[model samples]
Target: MSTAVHDHPHGHDDHAHHPSGLARYLTTTNHKDIGTMYLWFSFAMFLTGGVMALVIRAELFQPGLQVVNPDFFNQMTTLHGLIMVFGAIMPAFVGFANWQIPMMIGAPDMAFPRLNNWSFWLLPPAALLLVTSLFVPGGAAAAGWTLYPPLTVQMGMGMDLAIFAVHILGMSSILGSINIITTLLNMRAPGMTLMKMPLFCWTWLITAYLLLAAMPVLAGAVTMILTDRHFGTHFFNPAGGGDPVLFQHIFWFFGHPEVYIIAIPAFGVISQVIPAFSRKPLFGYTSMVYATASIAILSFIVWAHHMYTTGMPVQAQLFFMYATSLIAVPTGVKVFNWVATMWKGSLSFETPMLFAIGFLFLFTIGGFTGLVLAIVPIDIQLHDTYYVVAHFHYVMVAGALFAAFAGVYFWIPKWTGRMYDETLGKWHFWLSFIFFNMAFFVQHFLGLAGMPRRIPDYALQFADFNMVSSIGAFGFGLAQLLFLYVVVKCIRSGEQAPAKAWEGADTLEWTHLPSPAPYHSFETPPMVK
Candidate 1:
């Protein structure tokens, strides 16, 4: 009744191969395997999306169109955004949840294993639809990833496929959220009170709640798009008594929160890494949890910020501008807390900590630009331009992706019981850091100078910066092969690792369990006392 499964003994016969059928995954509820699947699938999607980015960069390497036309360029951006957000970043974090959460909480598995598996399996089909649409007649969706109507309405079969794919992916996210909330709420190990839980779990709990609330709204909005396309409703079409602006309102209602949904987990990952490498307890853990919750609450109200360019009245614009700015306060608190956690602590710059420090500086730069964009006046000039493009990529690629890689490197030893090559890791970090900045930093000037986003070609003045960015892009892309090598080498054969992989690390995970956890881990509950 307590939902604590510690010492739940079973004979060897209790272990049998789980049934292998489509139904096994369609209805799976296991946490570890589901988490593993999510992470690997996300890595694959990252590569796929990266390839799309490479195509974009290759075309832009010169002054004119080369690899793709404007239409195909549009498709590449749309699909790239979709895959990286839903397919890569989101799934990677969820995968981390599957592997780490139960272990941290001392639970045998997630609250609902079948639901866990179901959430992961649903993703493949959804991803397939989005990818395969490129080969379909009239090609994949070319309406920008936002799928802003009028343009979206003009799209062909690919739009329909993307719409359905969104629905499927949303369903998957909603289900995963439910499982995470249930597990955290119901399955904490004895003595692990809510306050005692790590920031990673706390941040995830708030994120899951946001997902539960916002994904449904996205599903509903896309449902309307589907109806408009096939069933003749005018929810987003102004010519038919509906408002195109209404579509943006509805989409951003979901879209704004979705940004935090991807980011908050990265914050959690950094929270874990900073403390581990800095040799101290996380500073202000309670405040961090409350701050995350506050961010989620604020996310819902700020949806209109993305819609300021859509001709909202002055009152709406002013209200949204101020409300969006409020987010900076809570975000500021989180940033301050991380630095404080590291203050005066004996720190070693491990691979994980290196990325965390990188995240701190880069994410702050990103947050500052976000505040700049939050102002109605600044946004009026910057919106829909490369400045906006530069801003979000700084946050997403530099902020989120960097933290994710840090988390992966920090935990790889525990997961595989082998230490990765540190020299190789250093190579991966420096190359990525320098080139990522090189690729994106100059774009701020281009955007300010009035270069628009999503264009396959640009004016002569923009040529030099675009060429530099493209070269940096290739450098960043090729550098990831180092990451792939490090992971594979560790998994295959590397230096043996200990149970408490890092000297400064303190968690329920380090207190118990061996490296390279057995295939059938936690069949009996782990004792937390």
Candidate 2:
């Protein structure tokens, strides 16, 4: 059940690379090229979302609104969450899956290569719809990222545009899921059995299925909103015999799993990166697999935790509360497995490892906060406060975003055929780690102190912490420019990388493939022993 792929290199002509330029990108089916596109697109959107975040932070810098009004501030909040979640983080992982999966599994390319191309292409128009909606008449959906109703139902053309964008994104996710699932199931090398595959693949396998199952529910939720808004229906409209609370049920059903959709992949990256730097096989690999599956199974039952404030019956609230707490068990199993992997191994503090460690520390805080929020009495006090905001950023920004930076540092050498400046990489890590904490950590105090989220202005006492957060937010945003420079320098010309850049890296990409993986990763099935 434990195995690794052993791919054989082919003749030089087999490296017949794809054509260069805009034309090639427009029509190419090469997964590496496509993966590059996804990463770049995600980065672009990351900046877009980050800017929106700064606008939010700046407005809140003082008790009184300084820059924007409440309505526009809500727009920034709405678009920021949507862009970061769908446009930045999700695609970034898909980029990794596109680049890593076939290579790791010892297959030539994705099973449905053309479908892969279409799936990636679908993102731009979707992102455009979201971003450009700002210039529209009603000025985007001010109804927060959740798109809760009555508010959403009354919003303008921008809302419809957002709905269409969600539909397209859902379609894109479905198509990408199908490609990933089909490739993993049918195209894996002869000996790469399910249990033998890398933890990253397993996480993605679960994540793809999560997407397949969860995305349609979101599609249905949004579709109902669209119909209710434009058509004669009142699914969430009280006047039309609709129940708005029902929308929360549907949305959270999709939304809760969406949290894992992002985190699971981040967990996958941490799994790979931690073991590599620690020079150890992942501890509890088998348990990690089972724990992942368990978490996925538990995700469905816990959706209603978000609805605790809606005045559902105590029995229903208790069901969701306990169910929510149960997910932490498997999640903790993952955390324990990671820590055990690094317990006494030959650890190195490379940029990737630094980011991985940061992820572990901050993500745990995020989880603890999540558990705190899971309690009915506590959540009733803290729900929708800056405390909730602090919790998720710790999860999404520290947890998922840090993991992403770790992955990029870990693999940039292989992807680009060059090693990045180690000093710059380290600088990037330290700066990001420091500035990130500055920005969001105080928000916890703000939340505990009762500052609400999505508001442009706040009460007098919250001013100092808001200023600190704004400064930290700006610093955090600036640190990413260094990350961008580091990656660009690597691609343009850093140091030439060897076949195995990291001596401890043991996967097929490191052990078998050259520094830059060949255009056709597996011309024939690799004999991985």
Candidate 3:
């Protein structure tokens, strides 16, 4: 993708309305449009996935499967994980990359424009297949997102649908990675060296590499499972000399890094937003870069941490335990940098800043819990419990999802040239923060009290906390409506934003672009210095 912004009537002149048509979306490969598509699509998937979460929470509300059948609840859980991971969070970050990277780096478009279009178009059908699975005779795969065998083998058409969807989603992600890598490497404007790229770009570059390496592994793992389910292979079937544990080895080999692939850019977003709101250059820029790369490298070796309870040998257990624990060091460095950047700076808590702070506090709580879970003995007690679920929700939702919202609020002026209602944004932030923690925090106690995960019903002893969690879930769900309203209101009408929306912002993006960036950007590279 070229990085130059060109003069155009629609993107440049805010008054000019562009045509809305299939062709406009289909034929054009503009990074902004594609980025918009990804954001909107991911938002749609979020609602879809969120509904599934509601179903899960509702079913577990009173522990008697009130709203849905046990089978459907299982399906909801499985689909919810799949959609949130692939359809929501992954695409949202890619959307951010598409919208921001070129602008930040002074590029015109992605490196491979047509391929970008192809990558996005692939998602809808794949998403449709996933949604469509619930209606199939055997219902959506109840095997959970992990798709471990025996149970997975029993799932009928839904499993096949899921496998096929995985193929398409994987292809889309890989192609998207290729486009990103190409753009960052080959399309950066003159004087924009690799080290000079923004933290978001750096994190994404590493994420894309992780995606490239791990997505193929996922593809292969799923394909093998598909063959095992249909073609009489025993890749994970003990009856035929294949081992289920082997399946885990391969899956986690991909799955663990896949966690960071979704998260590292979130770290980048938090890094970007903190400095802007804090009015300080990011502290430890080089340390942040090295920390992210270190995380990516360590992610490969720590896959077995998820499987410590599967009776791995003692040495294997110790290795994964220690390897996984080491990640906390780099992650801690990142947290310290963010806090240090804010120390004694001219910090005003804007909505974006509020969310960034929320991410730090809540994500740190999750990280501490993760360290506990990383210990082999504790993992034995907590594996596959609501405790584990709570941990990741903090990391993914409070961490990744919160950071995603911050990125949106921080850049909305650039995207829409309108300031969102600040009062409403703050309302959305506080309400979301309170309700989100309300929903997931107590789940830790529930997990500690011997409640297993993925079950629709629980014993009477677990009722009180579960009720609290359910109420919190509904509240959190309602709060997102406010988010939708805030975003839509900004898009429709708000105070006009200036060329540089935030005072402390320093990316090439703010320097080169107007409020609401041009459809074609940077016809000529601006001098960086």
- Writing each residue's lDDT as its tens digit, candidate 1 over 356-470 gives 9999999899999999899998899998888988899989988899999999998888788899998888889999999998889988998999999999998889999998898
- Mind giving the per-residue lDDT tens digits that candidate 2 earns over 1-529? 3222334444222455577779788888988988999999999999999999999888887788679988899999999999999999999999999999988888878989999999999999999999999999989989999999989999989999999999999999999999999999988887778988999999999999999999999999999999998788899998878999999999999999999999998999999999999999999999999999999989989998898999999999999899999989999999999999999999999999999999999999999999999999999999999999999999999999999999999998889889999999999999999999999999999999999998887888988998899999999999999999999999998898998988678888888788777777666666677
Q: What is each predicted model's overall lDDT from 0 to 1?
A: 0.87, 0.92, 0.92
Residue clash pairs of candidate 1 = 6-525, 28-113, 28-114, 29-113, 29-114, 30-113
Off by over 4 Å in 1: 1-29, 522-529
Residue 224 alpha-carbon offset, candidate 2, angstroms? 0.7
Off by over 4 Å in 3: 1-19
Model 2: lDDT of residue 69: 83
Q: What is the lDDT of residue 474 in candidate 3?
A: 90
**Residue by residue across 316-360, what tens digits does model 3's lDDT show?**
999999999999999999999999999999999999999999999
User: Between the candidate structures 1 and 3, which one is better when assessed by lDDT?
Assistant: 3
Clash tally, candidates in order: 6, 1, 13
